[model samples]
Target: MRTDLCGRLGSGDAGRAVTVCGWVDRRREHSEHLAFIDLRDHSGVLQCVVDGARDLRSEYVVRIIGTVTLRPEGTANPALATGEIELQDCEVELLSRAEPPPFPLDERTDVDETLRLRHRYVDLRKSRMQRNLRARAALNRAIRRAMDAQGFVEVETPMLIASTPEGARDFVVPSRKEPGSFYALPQSPQIFKQLTMVGGVDRYYQIARCLRDEDLRADRQFEFSQLDVEASFATRDDVLGFVTRAVAEATVAVAGHDPGTFDRMTWHDAMERYGSDKPDTRFGMELAELTPVFADTEARVFQAPCVKGICLMGGAETLPRSRVDELVATCQRWGAKGLAWMRVVAAGTGGSALDAGVAKFLSAAEGAAVIDALDASPGDMVFLVADERPLVRHVLGLLRLELGRPPVNDGRFNYLWVVDFPLFEALNAEGEPIPSHHPFTMPHEDDLPVLMSGQPLDGEALLGLRSQAYDLVLNGWELGSGSVRIHRRDIQQRIFEVLGIAPDDAQERFGFLLDAFRYGAPPHAGFAVGLDRLGALLVGEENIREVIAFPKTQSGADPLTDAPSPIADTHLQELGLRVLPPA
Candidate 1:
């Protein structure tokens, strides 16, 4: 007899005969005469009752032929939909018995993550994992719906392609047919998606998988999926606006709340105000500049070039000297030389009271000016970094994020548009300028002459020459980034020159994209949203692995599958590879 899924049985089907099939979630002997089993499937859970003569165990594959009956008076469980009713079984068959599980399947059980990952299949049976997977499915569906509604045609890009080593390392696959040749998995479908725009697929979208060989973080994985999109005849504003709306809709649909509208900020403003492009706006405590106020001061720390400060709310008098020292140590870890701090206090009849660190260096007027500039209150403390602009910004930005309270369950989303990114970052170890985002990003039209003139451009000037690039940030986490691509061959060539990519190297590495651009390429731009990060955020988990069915550990090792293992010699021969002995 055919059976229905366990989660489908409910109070509406009471008094009707039904066949149910699922894994026994939990089994309990209600009394000597009766037994109740909680059965679960991918959809949800249901309760099943059988005579005590039959034996059932947890995780056993079971089939029951019974009538769905409403629970007796005072027995209905309001916590579950199927709780109001249960299946009264007359016949039961134990399809497969299960051994004792290594770990509990309930959400409340606190188990070691290493053990959980080792038995991911069993771990996925837990309620938390079930919820995460369901939320992931719903999020993907919402993304598809949103993209389709925006007139974007869904398309698939290639998986294997040439390696353009720029931002991150590539995972290479040896080619058996071509000896000594290798193919790298696409870091992103960046080139292919741009080519799709050139092919005149006015608008395109793909739930694409990307692989990158890089250091792992809570939000990063070896192979992750992204909601990739590209649009022809679109500007930076059009793409940013589309992503903002799509993110808001997706967040509301998946998390049951809207993220609301995003605030726009330039790279400079973000650095000066919050010290991070992805700033957490949920709380106060913005960074302020004190360079002008300390320009002529006798303070040795402020004697250097750029000086910026951030006032910790209600932190001046309360923050201890040891805590301030610890903050300084944290800055040093991020490559800052040292950290300088001053406590704001009330002015006395004799003179202005100040922290010992800067008391002798500052005159009364200068001290007051510093306090007024930062808008410091009596109880607030101010921390300053004095160094080059980039280091100062980096140090302060990191401190700002670190000092804020852990993210809370606030329903409102703080969205931001980080625009005006630099086209080229500083020179690499080889003294060649590197692409800030990527080589395909178009330089600002007005900056083309400056780029072609071959004049040496510093980081500040290059940053001011903004590209048509932008990143979508939600609550200080970068959701995605995109830029209007370089379509003109001459402009593309100029970018290559700026990045120190030789003519021969450019033709070899990016010939396919260049040739495609030559054939009627339109003005197009695209962005990629990290599906794993989005899923994790929607499920309210700290790490992306919580939502993934099978995720590798921080070391990029999969405990369940034991991947990255050495292959047999025969298999290696097929791939034209040989394992070298450890030197």
Candidate 2:
């Protein structure tokens, strides 16, 4: 007999005979003549009543043939959508019996994360996991709709390609057919997507899977998908506008609320105000520079010209001395020399204008100016970090996030365009200057001459040299980044040269793409949004793993399949490989 989903049985079908199939969520014998069982499937749950039944167990795969009956008035469960009606079973058939599960599938079960991952198939049966997965699917659909509507053609790029020694370390695979050679999993479809524009696909997109062998973070995974998109003959504004609307709309459709409009900020402004590029603006305790204030003061605090301060509104008089000390210690741990605190006391009532290690060092006027600059009032506490400018800003920025006060503009989805990132970061331990974003990023036209002149752009000058690049920041997190690519072969080669990439090495590594650029490549720009990260954030989970079906653990091991395992020696031999002894 055909059966219906348990969640499909409802009060609307009262008195109709129905066959429901699902796992028995809970079975209780309410005396010999009455029993109530909660049946559940992916759709939802339903209550089933057995007028005469003796034995039942949790998680039993059962089929119930019954008539839908409304729950008696006042017996309705307000917690469930199907609470108003239940199925009265006249016949029951046990389809499959289940052994006791390692952990209950109930949402309330508090199981260890490691244990849950090991038994992920069972864990996914829980309602929370089900919801996360459903939300992720919806998000994917929304992305496709948005991109397709924008006239983007979905494209697929190769997974195994020549490895380029740039950015993150690659996960390489030995080529059995071509011994002594390897194929690297794509870190991103970066070069290929740009090449698509070269091939004259004006607008291209993909729900592309990317792999990165980098240190894992809450938002990062070894293998993840990104909504990669590129457009020929489009400017940064065009790219940014499309992504902003698409991402905001997708988020609202899946998350049930519009996060609101985005705000644009320069990279410098973000750093100075938030001390982080990806600032979490859910709360405010904005960083304030005290460099100038310190430069003029005789106070020991002034001895450090790079000192910065952040005032916790209304926390001055109430914060305990011990807690203040603890905060200072926290800054030190992050590489600050020390933390300075000033408690704002009433002007006349104050025996001391400022209270802390540096209190005595400040004159009355200098102390008053410091308090006024921060807009301090009685009972407001200000914490200061005295260190290098960047370190001071970094420490204070973290502390601001920790306090979680002053309330960020949570109601608004702040999308920002952080433009003008330095084209090149300093050399690494190997004395190789690394691309701040990547080597292919084109330098600003004006700065091209300066860069080629062999004079480095200082921090301030670097701010003026806008690349054909922009980042989409939503509510303080960088959702994605894209750039108007360097399509001109000469420009691409110049950038490589400035980056110290040898001509032979550049040709060897990216010869295909360079060759493609030679044949009338259109000016193109694109951006990639981390689909997993975006979905997790929309679902309000801390990690992207919540949205992924089969995610690896911190060490990049798949517990479900025990992947990255040892292959047999025979298989290695077939691959023309030999296992090396441990170093």
Candidate 3:
């Protein structure tokens, strides 16, 4: 409310009488007559010299008018932007007095998340949170600009709509007008954005709020935001290009560097090489193939349809026996029959040899073969899993991350586009192939013949069939996915038939969409970027909640608002709802 911001006063403003308003970050006594007050605003902190007797405490809101002057020799705080100058002979006005903070406000403090969340109004004053919040705003703005520049129109989608279950459990809202009906919150602008394409909006976009009644994790929350997009008459490459442009622009805008061209990999290759569809390619420790190495072995543990191992460089010395046992327990918990660990040691012939775990079960030649297969160094520790291919990949993928994955922000950005996902993940008990993305996804053109054939497809052939779906992954986190839509009704019906969804049942669930398709739906493709995850990555935060302004705790409770609390009986009755006892 004055001549300058606290942080905006520098040496160039020397001899200038300026006024500044901010909260008192710190107060220190310099002498009986003078004191130093670190006045802070969103920009930064500025040192103000005031009367020592003036009452000033941390977080006290105040305004000061003083002449900017150079600090005494050798007292400059090079760490601060206004380090070279100080505001002297200040007139202080106490705007508001603040009580002592419940927890330390410094960046070094490790306050419990619940405590911080409960006092979020205060927690937000910290520099880290301030930076994160501002970065998110900037990222959103950049995304909007990118979309707009790409000739996409921003459209708002409905917050309440009929509950058509997709993947995650929907957070339903009771319809007050209709006694027993409910409206579900949109998980994404997925359907509405697609509808926009059908309605002839060639390109559509929105920074949509999404909700899912799902378990919370570091990267997931019940409520989140995404950059939703859809475009009519767009091919797979067209959608990828649009999404890449937006994301790369946002990354550069927030992180100040281009991520260059995003790398591409087939889902099969990704799973085979790194054991994850979203592979973290920043570091090594790749899963090694060892099934053939033990094809003729006597070790029962290694006698499985699939066997894979990962070498933890220098893990032999870093991981103790207890830690190795814990890894074994962890593998077992992940459904592996047993985890086989071998610490590479010097052999009689100077080459490395496998020692410990399943080492004794193998012959000398087999032991050497195991060591060679994994490319294990003498000081390394190798963990092996033997089971079906899927189990082996799942266990070893997690194990690889446990052993060698870098911190979320430690490595350079490695944007990836994973394509060629299976058209169906698996077959259900009724021998119907489960749709991977959705029933509407267009099967890859090359696989159309197989689908069109009258002969029933086998589980292997169905599972091997690739859809046109693709995912945008960053550092092992799946940002979002999209696929080309089947514009033709016949293709859609055929997909439903494959999934064992009868015409009547399909009509009931997706009647509106099917009816719209009869009016000539255009071929479209789209993608959504999880803005929360992207923001977290841009700000170097491991948890998406850190970047979110007000986020639910891991238990999905909002400490600030005390949300999810019980409602009054009268309120529930208004919506014709009643609470029921737990079974």
What TM-score fits each model? 0.92, 0.93, 0.97
Please give, for residues 200-269, the per-residue lDDT of candidate 3 as tens digits.
Answer: 9999999999999999999999999999999998999999999999999999999997999999999998
lDDT by residue (330-415, candidate 1, tens digit) is: 99999888887778666666333456656567777767777777788777787788899888988998888777745634555677
Cα lDDT tens digits for candidate 2, 432-473: 456678767777666778766756554445444547666776
As a whole number from 0 to 100, the lDDT of residue 396 in candidate 3 is 95
**Worst window of 10 by summed lDDT in candidate 2:** 405-414
- lDDT value, residue 250 of candidate 3: 95
The lDDT of each candidate is 0.81, 0.78, 0.91
Give the top-scoring candidate (lDDT).
3
Which candidate leads the pack in TM-score?
3
Output candidate 1 Cα RMSD.
2.7
C-alpha RMSD of each candidate structure in angstroms: 2.7, 2.8, 1.4
Better of 1 and 3 by lDDT: 3
Error of 2 at 24 (Å): 1.0
